[model samples]
Target: MDAGSMKAESRCPLQEQFLQRKNSKENLDRFIPNRSAMDFDYAHYMVTEGRKDKENNQAMSVCSPSKEAYRKQLAEVFNMNRTRILAFKNKPPTPVELIPEMHSSSASASSSVQQAKLNKPRRHIPQSSERTLDAPDLVDDYYLNLLDWGSSNVLAIALGSTVYLWDASDGTTSELVTVDDENGPVTSVNWAPDGRHIAIGLNNCQVQLWDSTANRQLRTLRGGHRSRVGSLAWNNHILTTGGMDGLIINNDVRVRDHIVETYRGHHQEVCGLKWSASGQQLASGGNDNLLHIWDRSMASSNSVTQWLHRLEEHTSAVKAIAWCPFQSNLLATGGGGGDRCIKFWNTHTGACLNSVDTGSQVCALLWNKNERELLSSHGFTQNQLTLWKYPSMVKMAELSGHTSRVLFMAQSPDGCTVASAAADETLRFWNVFGAPQVISKSAPKPNREPFAQLNRIR
Candidate 1:
């Protein structure tokens, strides 16, 4: 053979190597892991791998039917068919705007209109206070709960040594009682469920039960704490009190010997206290940054009662405590300046459900009696009241006006108005939560009544 015949018959060494590598089994075949054997994110894997498969399919004009049948068979054996994997009978319909050619000219206009609808607020929220009243001598202390609104359309507030009641029905303000210089300034005030009865916690470490209807002092209960009493809650006739000495006491006001159960948990001043609507659970927050949920059935007159759940997640003092009116087991709590976050809990399981940073000290939290919305009062930087949508925790509105930190908040009986007291020495009322929707009379009520457990309290 001559040189010309050899050159025409053979190729370059580099070209031969390239051709061999191109048709190699290692380059053509890919390793696909058994997705069912390993617990990987199937959706993510499908999304990413599906994109690669589409690119490869586009690169090559020919597809092997036998190889495709093999993949389908593997998917069926593993019960991982793409459509059946997510258990969807059909794919979701694509939004009209997503498909462009159908309405090419009006596409931009239609999308903008849909965007406007989505961005609109669910309901209108007033940006200003409906009414403002001067709160002279109102205590500026963060740990003291000095304001409460009774269900009788009456609001009781402590100013200096006197306690006053403001009627929401007729817009009348009346003086309830004035303490002597020895017992002087009031620390906390709460109205009983009866609305006619009210409890006043004093600086002298005493809790006085009063009759607002007759304007008379019913009785004085003592020996609950060594320091000033700052928190009080009522579960039927049982009056629960918390003081600066880190003690929680349950007093049965119907009997002469009132101290029935003592909760021994907090090491710092107990500043916040609330009872569940069902009256089975009691939640308390303290200056030590701890929250404890106490079971009423665990109460013992023979021995000190222990807490059911001791939550130590707060980085600062927790003074804001509120029970969900619609959910008996759900509780909401807020931390102070050092920890500006609102946390939710499941009282039954003691699980922290959710937490949201409010960017300021949360002073008090209140749930709308008729709706799932929540209103939170804050301290520092704007001193505003924030209305939030539950579950989502979206800030619907920020009602601002107070010049100082809002220390206390109380809801009215109708759940329409909120009364907030700030260090600015003014009490402002905001109609943030809209009027509740009226249900039809023929509507079926739930078969279970959670609050019916209150019958077993005494």
Candidate 2:
């Protein structure tokens, strides 16, 4: 009895030490190791350690495909990877090879293959008409998508719920990154002209600025809007926001971003805002049908105390405004255009000049560089986009094809494209088709009854 017991005790410590030494380096048992050797019950300690590890990692760890030997077990857990996929042997696929259908694959299995395939140097395909030898890199079916031109990268916002990015060089609708804010809906989003940051206006009256480059949200602006901020315009570092409660806020969009002042004069909801090309003054239009111009050069305190000019025209709600790109003193109103009524105002005097009859309610307004010609879009029902034809007020082209209410319209910075976002869930591209092909006074009608009856039989 004495000899056998002593021999067993002696073997226990050596075995335990060897197991501990093996585990400390194998990368598997390094996370969990049995330490007790005096009890000669190493299985008990193993069970205890295994239970602890499982309890700590139940939500994260997954069993590894490798063998789990007597002294150690292999496990994997979800983790943030600092090591780049780019460092691997495989590169990302070329832009031309990225097909939307590839996204249907599960990320886990596809990611590794995708990275390798993308990183691999592409081989030029030899072009041929009928399988005869031809020059390489001359394939007819090389692929690329137009959306690829807008933004190569995107910033995820609202706790990784939404994304926002420039779609292309055109300053049209920002790729609207939607966040699951319980369908709270975003009232407005303003990207700084420099493209550094984006300010998102939430339906809950809270404002959040996302740092695009860092891809992490910095902070939130509380007490947001009196109601949700409806319009946001940026002039360099200063942000002017218009809200439903008739409160126009002047915010300092800096690292210590805060509301510097609030200008309250609009009797009803403030609907629109525009910064003069010179950036010295800001023009805002509201539901009160009044246009108010604020001189940005005024000190923050003065801004709140000063009430610039009260434009007392436009009998109905002043829905939209855009400053002339060339003329600092001129502003265009979109609510009323043509015979239906679009108002062009002299920013300096706040006086309405030349009420053009657009034959439809103005839904959006945009000005080109010289500011002589005004491009206006009417509501979705008629789907007419008219160019004021400069000082002449003649009708230009009337664009069609949008089936639902056109909710928003924006012009690209280069003036090469006009984008309209509508309730039909579509984005359309319209440009200079040149020369009118169709004409209508109010709405579309077949020239059948009167004109056909009078016409001679052919």
With candidate 1 superimposed using the best TM-score fit, by how many Å does residue 358's alpha carbon deviate from the native?
A: 1.0
List candidate 1 segments past 4 Å from native: 1-121, 439-458
The residue pairs in collision within model 1 are none
Candidate 2, residue 25: how far the Cα is off, in Å: 76
Candidate 2 TM-score, C-alpha based: 0.56
lDDT tens digits, residue span 1-458, model 1: 99856853663211111112243235646555554444347666676686686566455525676766666687689865554223313334444554354466587777777768666566668888877777767889999999999877898889878898888887777888999989969999999886777899999999888878888887799877898999999887788999899999998877667899999999999999999888899999999999999998888999999999999999999999999989889999999999999999999999999999999999999998876789999998879999999989998889998989999999887788899988977788888878756756775533222122332222
Report, for every candidate in turn, its global Cα lDDT versus the true structure.
0.84, 0.54
Clash count (model 2, backbone only): 21
Q: Candidate 2 on 1-458: residue-level lDDT in tens?
A: 69857754654210111112223236663232333312224344444664675464543434532223311333323221122212213333335534334455575466667668767663221111111111111111101001111122221122112333434433222334554566345666566664556677665666666555565565666664767666777776677777778888877655354678787779877767777868788777777777788876554654454667877767666665777766667787765332246777787777777786666666677765433567776663485666666667776555665555444555544454555544433445565422233434565442222112222211
Q: Which stretch of 10 consecutive residues in model 2 shows the poorest summed lDDT? A: 139-148
How many steric clashes between backbone atoms does each model show? 0, 21
Using TM-score as the measure, the top candidate is 1
lDDT of 1 at 64: 74
For all predicted structures, in order, the TM-scores are 0.71, 0.56
C-alpha lDDT of residue 326 in model 1: 90
